[model samples]
Target: MSVEVLSFGCRLNAYESGAMRELAVGAGHAGTVLVNTCAVTAEAEKQAAQAIRRLARERPGVSVVVTGCAAQIAPARWSALPGVARVIGNADKLKPEAWALDAAPAPVSDIMAARGVAAYPVADFANRARALIEVQQGCNHRCTFCVIPYGRGPSRSAPVGAVVAQVRAALEAGCQEVVLTGVDIASYGPDLPGAPTLGQMARRLLALVPELPRLRLSSIDPAAIDDDLWRLLGNEPRLMPHLHLSLQHGHDLLLKRMKRRHSRADALAVAARARRLRPGIALGADLIAGFPTEGEAEFAATLDLVGEAGLQFLHVFPYSARPGTPAARMPQLPMAVRRERAARLRAAGAERAQQFYAARMGEEEAVLLEHPDRGHTEHFCPVRLAAPAGARGQVLRARVTGADARGLLAEAA
Candidate 1:
């Protein structure tokens, strides 16, 4: 029998799905395919549904299983969709062998995760400059606008040993870059007894492969990072000089409404300190525009803080109401207003990114050369060129000459 698990959204889901694929292949199933799914935004959800429909239309009789945040959040919605012969929740996906005797079982697991894997190993097929390593699951913070916690449950972490194992595997798989991901990466170790902090986890991962290049932490909370973490980052050769601290809003009032732990000033201080340690480090943040009850001044402050904090990348999101969230109940701005804000913020982000890339022009950048089929770069900014006269997975020093709307433009210096 042929079985394929379709997973969606987030690196944790990726790790889980990878483990599931490994399970299928190990079980001697030759027609196993795992389709990873993502639904962070409505666009992601639409793509996933379209994929399911296409698969159903093109291939019949192949056992299809749907799993991940999208599946967990709306079981009935996904189950009702065609082509999904089985619906497994993320909680039980990794342990498919335990779910049923049939090589392809239907409705294997629900909202709960399946941790029935001897090892959570991922395929080394990613062509990007960085690899996303999931060390944790779930989120403790129930931000009014997010449905992650509702779908993923409270925070749970992979064993530290397992994390190190994964890191080593990624390195051996020829990934020069690694980014640790989770719904709440900052809350990584609390579930484990005497769990290591985010910084400690990075420290250990780097220690395992001291020569490992370009290690990064993803979407960490400003409040979670401290002097010790900064010191570790500054001292570590492998850790990248970039931080993506999630600042949902810049105004204190808006932050309160979002139930974020850190205020604007606190987030600013974190940026200041990080820059102090490494002038080359790129700072990034996620801003929500036209949020409920967000006044003109609140939005203005958000814009102001991006400049004030000197973010390298601004991921601006327009407010959208989900079915089960407090923000959905709150009075939202009109569609026109939300879209206008989003358009303006997106433009601003583009200009800022252009300026950031421009500054690197004529400067020496240590780029981790990746396969040129996509783009390649040392910094996260990607660039496309005619397939370079070289193989993939090689890092080179390139001097930035200009900016491509996509990323940076450069040549061998």
Candidate 2:
């Protein structure tokens, strides 16, 4: 059997999994099950462990190698898990030599000492319409509630030439859209010579890879968006209009307590600026529904921000306390409160999403066909075609016919 990768967590993890699969196969590791894990929340780690055990149980003789944020942070725990053949760290997972059949069973390294992100270009992602190019790696900021920095290490960017090459490879492989992803994409370029901003690098990439149909960015910090990126949002047609902000909370006090770089006012300003620059641009955010010391008023503030910021999409988390994080040491909210607040926030987001989708009725959109009957619009809204439109990876101009609870309904124009 071919080597299989089970990935968890962010888009970056998904991207890395593709690279890891290629490496494992190239290194002649057949019949291997690679578990790429996430450490964003305790639940995320728990799910990964469960998957590892299940995979082991189902494929009794297969080799299971664990890697990713969770494995990088706790190699001993993952290695001790039944049927795990090896445990690799984030820093070594992408390196070709680490995937060798004879490589050490557990060679997890010191992530904090890592200083650069080398481009591991993946030509294609299995069953994915969009290709993900990891523009940067790790993170420097230490948010009170986030353990990702510890798992990932310091911020480091892939060189501009490397990124362009990766994008070109994806285009050649018939990907219609490419998303530049990372742990903290907004913090790209400071480590590189000339210190080109994320926007500057993007501008260059588009110019170099003019054949690329659509370019998108993964979640970005509202506090760190550069002027060049803002200009791209305003003028670049190929750069998609959807922007997802890493806005943890909407309350100023909660924002401060979380040690986030941006304030409530700053987040509002960023959203307003994005809309002003690109009219009809779809906006989304990552919001923590309940945090340490969160009360009714604080939760309400975050709920209100959904409409206030015109957020059409939301990634809401019910504040899972990660061990060793500062927030875990603080007074914690009840699990019931956290889950309830999360439901409320998700409900608000769904309501706003329906509104956004309804507003797009009759508008012409460029839809990238991920499936024969379904794809997503330029705004990243899911659209179910009235009929089989085109082959997967083909871009079609379509007219929005209706909207529903799932997403927009469209027909090819």
Candidate 3:
């Protein structure tokens, strides 16, 4: 009769799923099936809906509750689905009482009205090597191609004290690393008391949690980095040297149409600055392909950005037009064209990644072994090693031996 959670989308959702599990179990609704969804792309929502139907069929008679960005934005649509017993908003999903039978069958609320983030207390991440601490919630900017702002509400910061406590709890629970995550992490703290910057938050967290061994950040906007955080990139070795940026497009015109804040020049500058501050740091970015008016020349700029930005890890998304987004109303590109451009970007990303791994073939790195056969380096590059059974969840020194399309191969040092 235990509650089961099926999570999809970002690492933040994964963290929230864990919290939801705790809430469900604590509320004594052990037989409920929770389908946490993502609404980033139309395809993501489609998959979530499909999964929901499959789960309901397989686990008959159980109350199937759907939540997450997809459900939050379109509660009526999901509620009408065959097997869904209820639909909850992103804002209400974390509340313990929301899991009770007396809770509304469709508990969607005005997520935009939420002034602050509710701290969903979690004791542990059952099988994670690292824990995610959500320091912010929602987004203030309305990127032309995004629907997440409406789903998540305005930006709200968890008090710095609450964040520190969460990290401390994670460390005490034996997590090796803690990743600070949010929808738009770089925009953190704008709504809080002092309107402290993300950089200031990072500095304070590290300084206050002196025993914290590794602190990582989720995807950030290049335009929002503050001076204090930038300095820490150079001085703090514990602030893991991997930065994943949200760089939607490489061409200025496309970027402008997408309502992005940074220019291509700004991206290149950040890449250079990261490397200068921390040698051998891994740079990752999220890039999209085949925007409405993107020409071959525009596509070429994005392809060239793989090298120009020195991106070692890339997440390339084929543009999918969401119904309400501004880009959706613009002249749409053919699906085939979008996918082909995405493939090209991925190929370039692979080439750069291999080059980065090859350069580290003879170097020594501290690998955090998440599994018996796999782990990642401080730069967040995947490394394959035959780790001892006892070494899982432990960080060990390793010497790299080779690189291939898969990842770097290493031997325990």
Q: Please report the candidate that would top TM-score against the real structure.
A: 2
lDDT of 2 by residue, 1-413 (tens): 79888999999998898898999888898889999999998899999999988977887867898899988888899999999988889888888888777876656889999978866888556466799999999898999999999899999999999999988888777898999999999999999999999999999999998899899999999999999999999999999999999998999999999999999899999999999999999999999977999999999999999999999999999999998999999999889989999999999999999999989989999999999999999999999999997988989999999999899998999
Per-residue lDDT, model 2, residue 390, is 93
> What are the per-residue Cα lDDT tens digits for candidate 1 across 1-413?
55566666656676666666667676666554456556566667788888888887888655566766777777778878776666666676666463354745555344444322234656653554566677777777878888777667777777778877777777777777777887788887766778677777777777777767778777888888855578777787567778887898889998899888999889889988888888767878888889899888888888788788888787777887777888889998997887788787777777777878888878866677666533445447775443463446656667677787788877765
State how far residue 76 of model 1 sits from its true place (Å).
1.8
Supply the global lDDT for candidate 3: 0.88
Ordered by TM-score, highest first, the candidates read 2, 3, 1
Q: List residue ranges in candidate 1 displaced over 4 A.
A: 1-8, 28-35, 58-62, 96-119, 123-129, 373-376, 385-389
**Prediction 2 TM-score vs. true:** 0.98
Error of 2 at 347 (Å): 0.1
Which tens-of-lDDT digit does each residue in 158-267 have in candidate 3?
88888998888888877789899989989888788999999899999999999989999999999988999899999999999999999989999999999999999999
Q: What TM value does model 1 have? A: 0.89
TM-score of each: 0.89, 0.98, 0.97
